[model samples]
Target: MKSTLNKTDEVNGTIVIELEKADYQENVDKSLNQFRQRANIPGFRQGKVPKSLIQKLYGKAVKADEINKIVTDEVGNFIRDNKLKILGEPLPDNSDEKLVDLENDEILKFYFDVALTPEFDLPLDKSVELTCHKVLLEENLLDEQMDAYKKNYGTYLSVEDEAKDTDLIKGTLTELSDSEDKDNLQVIENAILMPSYIKDEEIKSSFTGSKAGDKVVFNPKKAYDNNEAEIASLLQTTKDKVKNIDSDFSLEIKEVTRYQEAEMNQELFDRVLGEGVVTTEEEFRTRIKSELEKQFKPNADHLFIHEARDIIVEKMKEVKFPDEFLKRWLLETGENRTSEQVEDDYPKILEDLKFHIAKQKIAEENNISVEFADIEALAAEVAKAQFAQYGMTNLPADVLQNYTKSMLEKEETVQNLYDKATEDKIIDWLKENVTVIEKEISSKEFNDLMNERTRLQEEN
Candidate 1:
C-alpha cells in the first residue's frame, strides 16, 4: 500500500491512497476461515464446511468488508502521520469513479480533497489593547431592584374601602341589551375587574372613592379595548352575543384587594441571604452590592471576549483561506444542503472558523488547558442552577450528588459543559496575554458598544 499527499498550496491539498490486493488479503483470509467454521450447508456439518465452499458463497462480501476496514484505518493513519490541520473532514475527490472490480483489480486508488488550516502566529502583546467595561452599581438602581423584590414578596390584604388603580376589585358582571327576548339577552355574572380599565375618567374616578356596594357604569368592550371574548366571559354571555348587547355595563364592586409592602427586616434578609449571612442592614446592603458585582461578571466577561476578538482581528492581517477548495468541500460534505445555500453562509462560517483557530492558537501559546475536574465542577454548578429553577433551593447532599452524576452522564450535557470550560480557559488565556484597558461606562453605552461590535462582526 502507498499513501501520498499532493499539496496545491498552504491551505489546499489532495490525499491519494493506493491499496494492493496484499493490503487486505490477510484480513480477507481470516474472515473467510471464520465464516467456514460457522458455515452450515446441506451436505456439510456445522464447523466443518470447506474453505472453497465458503469463498464461493461469500467471497464478494468478505472482500468488500475487508477493503472498507483497510480504508478506515489507512485514512486515519495517513492524516495523523502528515500532521494535517484539517477543516472539518476530508471529502471524497469528485473526479474519482466509484466503480471498482475487486476480483480482478490488483490496486485500488482512493482520492480525497483536503482543506488545510493556514498557519498563523499569535500577536499577543501590549500592542493589542482590549477595553474591559466595569459595571458600577448605583444606589438608585439597587433601590429599584429592592423595590421589585419587595413587590414580589408583598402580602395581599382584603380591603373594605373603594377600589384604586393598585387595588383588585372582585364582583359579578351582567350584560344588558335592548333585546327583550330572554334567549337573546346576554348576562355575565361573578367577574373580577380592575377599575383602571374603565374608559370613562369620571366613572373610573368614582371607583377610587366608592365602596363595595357602589356601582360604576362603562362600556365593557370599549373599556377592555375590544376584548369581546373577555367581556363575554366577564358578563356571562356567549362571545357572539356580546357583540349584539350594549357595549356599556355596570360593575358592582364587592371586594377590594390591596398589596401590603414587605418589611425589610431580619426575616427578609435571612430569606434572601441564606440565614444570618448578613446580620445588619448595612452588611446586607454591602452583600447585595457584592452579589450584583458577581452577577455582572459574566456580562463583563462577554464584553471582554468581544473586545479581544476585535483586537485580534485588527492586529492580525493576511489570513489566507483556500476559499474554492473549502466551498467545494462544504458542498460535498453537507448532505441535505445545496451549494448555493452553503455559499450564502460561507463568509460567516469562514470568519467564525478563523476566530476559533486564532483563539485555539492563543490558548496553545499560553498552555491553557481545561481539566476533567474543572468540567465536573461546572456541571455541578449547572445542575444546582437547574434545581433552583424548579424551586428546590436547599437540595440534600445525596440528592445533589445524584443530580450532578445524572447530568454529567448525559452525552450532550457533558459535551456542553466541556465546551464551556474550554471557552472559559481560552478567554482567561486571552485576558492574561492581551493588554486590557479598563473603561467605566454606563450600561446603555456598554450595550451600544456591544451592539456595534456585533454589527461589525456580522457585516464582515
Candidate 2:
C-alpha cells in the first residue's frame, strides 16, 4: 500500500491512496472462514460448510468491508502523524463512496479531498481598543426597581371607601331571574369581581365610588361586550356553562382589597435578599446598585464584541479557505439541504466561522479552560436568573446548589454551561489584555446605541 498527498495551496489539497490485494486479502480470508463455520445450510452441518461456497456467497461484501476499514484507519493515522491542521473532515473525492470489484481487480486506488485551516495572527493584544459601557444607576432607575420590589412585597387590605378601578372587589354574585324557578336564579357564593375589567363605560361607572355593602346590578353580557369567558370568570363558572345565558346579576360588595406597597425596611431587605443580608436602607440601595451593574455587564460585553468583530474580520480578510471543497462537504453532510439554500446561507456561516476561529485561537493560546467549578458556578447563575423570572430573588445555598446540580445532570445543560463559562473567561481575558476605554453612559443612551447597532447590522 502507498499513500501520498498533493497540495494545491496552503489551505486545500487532495490525497491518493493506492492499495494491492495484500492490503485486505488476509482479512477477507479470515472473515470468509468465520462465516463458513457459522453457516447452517439445509444440506450441510454447522462448522462443516465448504469455504468455496462461503467465498462465492459473501466474498464481495467481506472484501468491501475489510477495504473500507483499512482505508479509514490509514487516513486517520496519516492525518495524526502529519499533525495536519484541518478544517472540515476529509471528503471522498468525486463521489460519496465507491464500490470496488475484488474478483477482477488486482489493485485499487482511492482519492480524498482535504482542507486546512487558514492561518492568521489576530491583532487582539494590548493595542486593540474597545469601549466597555458602565450603565449609570440613575435615580429614576433605582426608583423603578424599588417600586417593583414594593409591588412584589405588597399586602392586600380591605377598603371602606369608594371602589377604585384598580382595586379588587370581593362580593357575592346573585344571579337575577325573571322566571319562577329558584334553581334558575344561580347564585355563586363568595364570587369576586373587579369592576375595572368591565368594557362598557356605563356599567363600569356604576361601580365607581361605590362603598362596601352597596348593591350594583349590571348586565354581564353587555358589560363584558358579550365575552362569555370574562363573564364566566367573574361569575366563577366555565365558559361552556354560561355561553348562551344573558342576564343581569346583583353584586353586593362585601370587601374591597387594595395592595399596599411595603416600606423600605429591614423586613423588605430580608424578604428579597435573604435574612440579615442588609439591615440598613443605605446598604440595601448600595447592594441594589451593585447588582444592577453586574446585570449590565453582559450587555456591555455584547456591545464590545459587536464593535470589535468588524475590525477583526476586516483585518483577516486575506486569509482564505477551500471554498469549493467545503461547499460540497456541506451539501453532502446537511440533512435535505439544497445547493441554493447553502449558497444563500454560506456568507453568514463563513462570518460566524471566522469569529469562532478567532475566539478559539485566543482561548487556546492563553490556556483558557472551563473547569467543573466554572460550569457549576455558571449553572448557579442560570438557576438564579430562572428563579428571578418568577419573583424569587433569594434562595438557600443548599437549595440553589441542588437545583443547579440537577440542571448539570443533563448532557445539553452541561454543554451549555461549559460554553457559557468558556465565553465568560474569554471576555474577561479580552477586557484585561485589550485597551478597554471605560465609558459611563445612561441606560437610555446605552439602549439607543444597542438599537442603532442592531439597525445597522440588519441593514448590512
Best by lDDT: 2
Candidate 1 lDDT score relative to the true structure: 0.75
Cα distance off (Å), candidate 2, residue 187: 3.6
Tell me which residue pairs clash in candidate 2.
none
lDDT of 1 by residue, 1-460 (tens): 9989889988888788888988889999999999988887899899899887888999999999989888878888999987878887877765637446677777888777788888877667766777777877778867876776577667878888766776777775555556565474434456776667666566567667767877777777666666788766667658996675554667776777888887788876776656777788788778776666555555688878766766666555578888887788778778898988898989867767777888778667767778889988887777766665433444577888888898888899888888788887877766676687887866556667768867976886
Query: How many Å off is the CA of 162 in candidate 2?
Result: 2.2
Which regions of candidate 2 are displaced past 4 Å?
Answer: 1-9, 16-58, 77-83, 95-103, 118-124, 178-180, 183-185, 244-248, 314-324, 327-351, 386-392, 395-416
lDDT of 2 at 235: 78
Candidate 2 residue 370 Cα shift, in angstroms, is 1.5
Q: Give candidate 1's root-mean-square deviation (CA, Å).
A: 6.9
Candidate 2, residue 367: Cα displacement in angstroms equals 1.6
Please report the TM-score between candidate 1 and the true structure. Answer: 0.69
lDDT (C-alpha, whole model) for all candidates:
0.75, 0.84
